[model samples]
Target chain A: MDNPNLEDLLIACRQGSDDAFRKLFEQYHMRVMSTAYRMCGNIQEAEDVTQDVFLKAFKEIKKFREAASLFTWLYRITINLCIDKERKRQRRQKYHENVDVDSERITIEEANSNENTRTLDQQMWQDEIQSILQKALSRIKPKFRTVLVLKDIEGLSYEEAAQAVGCSQGTISSRLNRGRKELKTLLVKMGMGEEYFQER
Target chain B: MKHGFTQKNLSAYLDAELSPDKVQKIELHLQSCESCLRELQEIRSGKAVATCFENPDWQDTEALWQNIQRLNISTPEKGDVKNLEMKRTNLWQRLIHPRPAFAIAVLLILFGINLFSNLKQKKFQYQRVQLDQELSYGFDYGLYLDALVAGSPAIEFERRYESQQASYEQARSQTTFRLASFTHMPKTFQLREVRLLKNACCRSVQFSCLENSREVIIFQQPQGHPVTFGNYPLERIELNGQMYHRIKTGKWTVLSLQLKESQFMAIGEMNESDIAAIIFAITTI
Candidate 1:
C-alpha cells in the first residue's frame, strides 16, 4: 500500500526527500521519456528532454501541490520545454527556410506525390493497418494531437489527460472527438477505412 | 439516424455515459454507417493494443529511481566551475602581483562602459534624425524603455486607421483570450512597452500584413550581431480596418513609423523577450 503513487512521490520530492523524488522519477521516467519521444519525433531529443524535465522538476518540486498529479505537472513542463526546443531548432533552420522562395516545403504537388506518400507510409506508418491510423493521427491539429497521444496512445483517463495537457475535461473530450473524426477521415483517404480493417 | 452519431457519442455509448435514447440512436447510426463502424473498430483495436503496453515494467524502473538520489544533487550553473578556476588563478596572482592589476581591471570596466555607451549613441545617433523625421517623433531610448517596463500612460486613443486595439498592463495578460485570434509576441521576450503607432507615422513592419496590429516591441537591448537584410528598406503597410500586424525592430533592424494618430517608432537592439511587457501594453488610442 505504501508503494508511492504519483501524489506520494510528489510530496516526497517536495520535502527535499531524495527517495520520494527518485521513486516518482522511477515510476514515470519511462512514461515521460516515451511521451516526449512520441511528442517529438526523435529519441535523443526525448532523452535530453527527459533529463531536463527531471532537473527542472527537482528544482521546482517545491511548487508541487495536490491540485494536480505529479505526472501532470511533469507533462506541462515537458510539453513547454519540447515546444521551446522546436522553436530553437527553427531558429537554426532559418537559413534553409529563408532560401526557398516558392513554398514552405509543403506544396500541393509534394503533398500528393508518391515520394512523399512513400515517406509518409514508411515513417509514420510502422506496420500494416498502423499506417492509415498514422495519417489520421497526422491530420489532427497540434493541440488535439497531444490529447490523443495522452488518451489513446498513452491510455490516460480523461481527468489525467486534462491535467497533463492543461485543459478542461470538456475541452479534452471535444479535442478527442474531433481528433477521432480527423483520424478516421485520414484512414479513409489512405484507402484503409472500414474495408481494410474489416478483414482484421 | 442519417448522421447516426459522432465518434464522441460512440465512445460515450461504450463507456455507458450516454442516455438510453442517445445510445439507441447511436446504435442505429453505427449499424448503417460503414465509416463510423470502422473507426469504432479501429479505436477498440488501438485501445486493446495500448493496454498491452501496461506501463511496460515501470515496476522494474527501480534502477532509474537511483536518479532520485540526485534530488539532493546540487545543480551547478554551467559557468560556475570555470569561473571558480578563473577566480582561483586570479586569487593566486593577487597574492603575487597586486596593485596595478586591480587598477587595470577597474579601468577596463569603466572603459568598457564608456566604449559601449559611445558605440550605442553613435549607432543610434546616426539613424536618429532620419529616424526621427520618419517616425514623426523625437527618439529617446531611456524614456521609452521605462514607460514600457512600468506601464504606458492610460491615454485615451482615437485612431482613424485602427480597426481594433487591446492593451494589457503586463505582457503575460495579453496572451490570454485577447490574443486567441492570433499569436501574441511571446511573453519570454520581457516586453518593455506596448505602443500602437499610426500607419501614417509608425515605422515599417517588415514581415507582417495585419492591418492596424497591436505591435508588442520587447525592451531587450541588442547584443552580438545586428539584424541585416542587405539594403532593402523596410516595407510598411497600414492594416485594413481591423486586422493585427506584428513587427519587430531589434538592434539589427530599426523600424520607424510615421502615422497620423501618433509618432510610432520601434527601435530594435535587444532580444525580443526583454521587452515583451511593454509590447503587451499597446492599445488603440
Candidate 2:
C-alpha cells in the first residue's frame, strides 16, 4: 500500500476500526512473522511473537506518534518479543540439554518440502545451507545477531536498523562489522570454506 | 606501507559505511592485496547465504487475524472521545476565561449539577440493594489508599488523588485493558468513579465503588514496587492459582494480587472473606 493509504488506515485504526486494523495486519504480517522467525529460529515462537506485536500495536496505536514508520515500530516489538521468548525458553531449559539442532533441521526440511518451485536437488541444497546458517546465527549473541539480521537479512539500511533496534548509527555499523566477521568464521567452519567463497 | 587495514575497517568498507578518505584508502589497498580482496568477497558471500532463507510468506493470515480479533482490542470510541474532550476543555476554560465566559460557564455548571444529581439518585438506588449501611466513608479512605500507594517509589500520590476521579463510564472507556479483563463486580457495589494516575514512577488505575454508605477502592499498578499498607498483619494466600496478600486491620480488609504485569489491590470496610470473594471474582474473570 502507498504511504497515504497506510496513513489513512492508521488513523482509522486509531479511531477504533477493526477492519482498518485487519488491513494493516495483512500489509505487514509477512515481514513481521519472518523477522520473528529468523530471530528466534522457531515457528511456534515466531507465531506467538507476531500475535503479541500486533496485539500491542493495536492496543497502543494512539500513542504510536508516528515517530518511526509503522513497520519499524512493529519490528522493534517483534525483536523484543523474540528476545523475551528466547530468554524464557532458556530458563525453562535449565535442566535439559538443547535438542534444537535436530528439531530445527526437521522444521526446515518440512518447510521446504511443501514448495514445488525448486527442483528436489536445489531444495535439498538450499535447506542444508539455510539450516547451517540459522544454527550459526543462533550461536551469535543477541545484540550482534539483531543488527546483522536487520541489516543483511531484513535489508534495512543503517539508519532504519538503528531506529528499529533503538541504537545509534555508529552502534549499528560497529555491531554489523563484528556480526559479519563472526558469521564469516562460522560459515567457513561449516564446510563453506575458501572454495565456496571463490564460487560465490 | 602501513599495517593492513583492520577487519572491522574492511567490513565497514564493504558496507559503504566509511568516509570517502577511508573508502579511497581501503580501495587502493584492496587493488594490490588479493588476500584482503578474498576476505571481502567471503564476507559478501556469507551475508548472501544468511539472507537467502526466506520463510515462505506467512500463509496463515486468516487464522492469525481471527486470533487478533478475539482480543477485543479497539481504540477509544466516539462517545469516550467526546467525554474526554469535555472534561479537558471544561477545566481549562473555567480557569483561563472565568469572567467573560461566565454565562456559558454557568450553563455548563448547571447542566453538570443536574447530571450529577441524577447519577447520585441512581447510585443510591443501586447501593440500597447492595449495602444496608449509610455511605460512612469519606476522603479519609482516599488518604489511606494514597498512603499505601505512596509507599511505592516515585508516585506523587497526593497530586494524583485529587485529579484522578472520573465517572465510572469514563474510566471504563479509558482503561488500558478491556473492562472484561477487569472481571465481575458485585451487583450492589456499583462503580461510582474511576481515576487513572500516572507519572514517571508508576501508572495506576483506580476504580471506586459505592455500596450504601460504604466505599470500596480498587487500584492496579505494575508489579515489582515495594508496597506497604501500614503495620497491619499481611497473610499470604492463594486462590484460583493466583497468589494474594490479605491484610486485615480492624474493620478494613485489603486484598492484593499480582496478575500478569499488574498488581491489583482492593480495599474496603469489610471482612477478609468478602474481600477475598471480590478478589476472586475480579482476578479469575
iRMS (Å) per candidate: 6.2, 5.3
Report the error of model 2 at residue A151, Å: 1.2
The value of fnat for model 1 is 0.09
**In candidate 2, which residue pairs clash?**
B134-B213, B135-B213, B136-B213
Candidate 2 per-residue lDDT, tens place, A35-109, comes to: 888899877778767877887787679877673378888889889878987898888776233435456546545
- Estimate the lDDT of model 1: 0.49
> lDDT by residue for model 2 over B58-141, one digit each (tens)?
567789788666644332432232233344366767567857688788899999998997666432221111111122222233
Q: Residues A31-137, candidate 1, lDDT per residue (tens digit)?
A: 78767765664556776677677777777777667634667777777777776776677687652422322331233224445565657676433343343243345
**Can you give the lDDT of residue B116 in candidate 2?**
90
CAPRI class of candidate 1? incorrect
lDDT of each: 0.49, 0.63
